[model samples]
Target: MAMIVFYEKPGCMNNTRQKQLLAQSGHDVVALDIRAQGWSPETLRPFFHGVPVAEWFNRAAPRIKSGAVVPEAMAAAEALAEMCLDPLLIRRPLMESGGRRMAGFDEEAVNAWIGLTPVSEPISETCPRSDGMCSVPGRGN
Candidate 1:
């Protein structure tokens, strides 16, 4: 079992589920509450590596779903500035293992990267996890 540092929104249902899945997969999970940790922009930014800044958001959050926060319109500086102010805007369950960090949860990617157990995230048409839309809005912006 690989040791994983998972940062998450404490009361979020989806984050809890993700942690459960990881533990069931036989990985050693160390979960932390992102809000309580008082995140810094530099530290949080790495989790989003290679991912568009827009991908780093929680869909269920009021600020984001209300159409107030749009990632594509902002640069790295703008995005990080906004995220440091509000941890809720940041992605849930940022994961780190083996010196590599990843934002959000992609079952295939997780399995491929760190060898998660065979249990795959359930497929759904209705947004179950409330994670940001696969792509940030306004890609066609």
Candidate 2:
């Protein structure tokens, strides 16, 4: 198993589930809050390597849902600029392992890299709360 640094938004249920799956896959996860990290375009660019700007964003983010931004219309620099202006615009689970990094969790890619397989099927149901549904920090309750 490999150790992975997983950058995520705290209080996001999906992020929690993603972490759980990673652990179940036998990965050693080190989860960190994306907001707390001091990130710049220089550091952030690698996560999106070989990935399109649109793929780097959190499609569920309110701004994106409200159609305020369209990922395809923006250039890579523009996309990075916008995300630097609001980190929340970036996708969840910026992952790093084996000196390589990527944005979001591509199941196939992860499995190939770490030899993790699906034991239980994924939860198909979406989170049944408002977009702002958040929990108290440090309390998994």
Candidate 3:
């Protein structure tokens, strides 16, 4: 089984579920708090390799929702700088295993990377909360 390094926001329900699915699939999950990590552009950028700059961001973040940060409008360098300053702007469950890294949880993508046990329900990247926001620590529900 692969040892996956999972960066996540504490108290995020979706993150918890993702970790559970990984474990149930027999992978070893090393969960870390994404907000606590001291991320640099070079370090964080690799997780989003081949993906669009806009996809690197967490759409549920208050800054994005409030129109303070527009992912699609920012350049790569600018986007990286912003995300490093506020990890909340980065997407949830940044996963790295076997030298390959990816942002967000796409069940099919993850299964293709590492085997996943079939599940009845669909796993989604978007927050299931009614407000379309995650209850992050120091931020309210």
Model 1, span 1-141: residue lDDT tens: 789999876545566677787888889999987767777887888898888767777666667878888766778888888888987777776899999999888877888987766654552212354553332244420
Note the residue pairs that clash in candidate 1: none
RMSD of 1: 7.5
On TM-score, the leading prediction is 3
Candidate 2 accuracy as lDDT: 0.77
lDDT of each: 0.74, 0.77, 0.90
Candidate 2 lDDT, 68-109, residue by residue in tens: 989889998888888888777888778899998978776777
Error of 3 at 77 (Å): 0.4
In model 1, the runs with Cα more than 4 Å from the true position are: 120-141
TM per candidate comes to 0.82, 0.84, 0.92
* Per-model tally of clashing residue pairs: 0, 0, 0
What is the Å distance of residue 82 in model 3 from its true position?
0.2
Using lDDT, give the best candidate's number: 3
lDDT of 3 at 34: 96
Clashes of 3: 0
Using lDDT as the measure, name the better of candidate 1 and candidate 3. Answer: 3
Model 2 lowest lDDT segment of ten: 123-132
lDDT of 3 by residue, 1-141 (tens): 889999998678898889899999999999998989999999999999999999999888889988999999999999999999999899888999999999999999999999899989977787766454566657653
